[model samples]
Target: MKTFCKFLLFITLITLYQCKEEKKTTIIKKKKLDTETSSVPEKKIVKAWDSLNRHNTEAFLTEFGKQNPETKVLIKTDFGNIKLRLYKDTPIHRANFIFLTKIKYFNTTVFYRVAKNFVIQGGNSDEMYTQKERNKYGNYLLKPEFRKNRRHKYGALAAAREWKRNPNKLSSPFEFYMVQKKSGAYHLDNEHTVFGEVISGFRTLEKISKVRVGVDEWPVDDVKMTIEILD
Candidate 1:
């Protein structure tokens, strides 16, 4: 009986030791799993579009055009509202202008450059908000969509560009001008991309073009413009 009792105590001790080891091993495994889970990197969130660079600009604008298919817009200014219709031929420029309009970028800008009786340039301003607005959007230029039929007719709307060193004549996406001359500024036909034309705003264009301007062509009084999409 004494031998049996001793054997039973030994067995009990062994069993206890095994149970303790198993508990420690389980705790270690749980800790290891928790550490691994914490160390895993988080997934990145994707956006529909980002800053408009040369590489992604065309595709983004093309897609944006499909999504936001609007063409007619009204430009309200101190002079009067100019009703304009964007041409379908200049798809890229049309989409780009629509995108800018929808974003309310032109609301903070003005007719910064007005060449009396020749052209009234807008989409810029001297105010700090103008620069901030530009900074908020991506910096990019539109590839010129100079259609063979498009010309700088009276009240014609066209994109502005940096003439110096721009061989391709890539248009500045923000700045644009209207040919106020009745005879038409035919000289600028091929040089600038005529993306749209004044539907019925020649009188307003005439008034804006004749605003009193400084030596730099900027109006003495601010010519603020608020744009709204009609369709």
Candidate 2:
């Protein structure tokens, strides 16, 4: 009987020991899983198109700085090097262009739209994957910072907007049109944001402006643009 009692005690102790080990293993596994989850932070995902409506000027300034903090850019166009001095006054617009240029955002992109003796527009690509590439970077729009001092003069690089639909809402974040004619885009002075000007490349711009185009003024042969920062 004593032997039987001793055997039962031994079995009980072994069972308890096994249970305790299993409980410890389970706790360890849960803790490991928790630690792994905590280590990886959830990234704030934002679409490029959605970024346009942001009302925060500081946020716009921050992203602009991330993309283009420089004060000058050299557009290596087919015509020649169009050295441009970004407006120090228009900080948001200037910074944004610098960012796009530094990253070669306009490389290989065709001057999609051109108006003879008027404006030359670039930043869209004929390549099928250009839109996808743009998506990967950002989708945001710039709130128009139209100043009276910034006129739509010849050689002025101005942001393009969906003006027909966006009455009084001047916001064109990605695209820009250069004033090619000497008469100046006076009609556009109060309408669009005139951000930068051709400090040294007005002549090169004139040459590109003369390039022949189709119905939409899209240059028959692509006019590729590469950019470099000076200051």
Task: Give the top-scoring candidate (TM-score).
Answer: 1
Q: Please list all clashing residue pairs in model 1, or write none if there are none.
A: none
Q: Rate the local accuracy (lDDT) of all candidates.
A: 0.88, 0.77
lDDT digits (tens) for residues 35-65 of candidate 1 = 8878667778655544556567788889888
> Candidate 2 — worst ten consecutive residues by lDDT sum?
49-58
Please, what are the lDDT tens digits per residue for candidate 2 over residues 1-231? 999999999999999999999999999999999988786667999855335334554475667676555777788876888877777777787777776665566775767887978898888886755675566445556667788888988898888888677766655566788898789889988678888888887778888888888897888888888778898
Off by over 4 Å in 2: 1-60, 63-68
Scored against the true structure, residue 53 in model 2 reaches a CA lDDT of: 39
Candidate 2 lDDT score relative to the true structure: 0.77
Query: After best superposition, candidate 1 residue 66: deviation in angstroms?
Result: 0.5
Model 2 clash pairs are: 48-138, 48-139, 48-140, 49-139, 51-140, 52-140, 52-141, 67-99, 68-98, 68-99
Q: TM-score for every candidate vs. truth?
A: 0.80, 0.72
Which whole-number lDDT from 0 to 100 does residue 68 have in model 1?
81
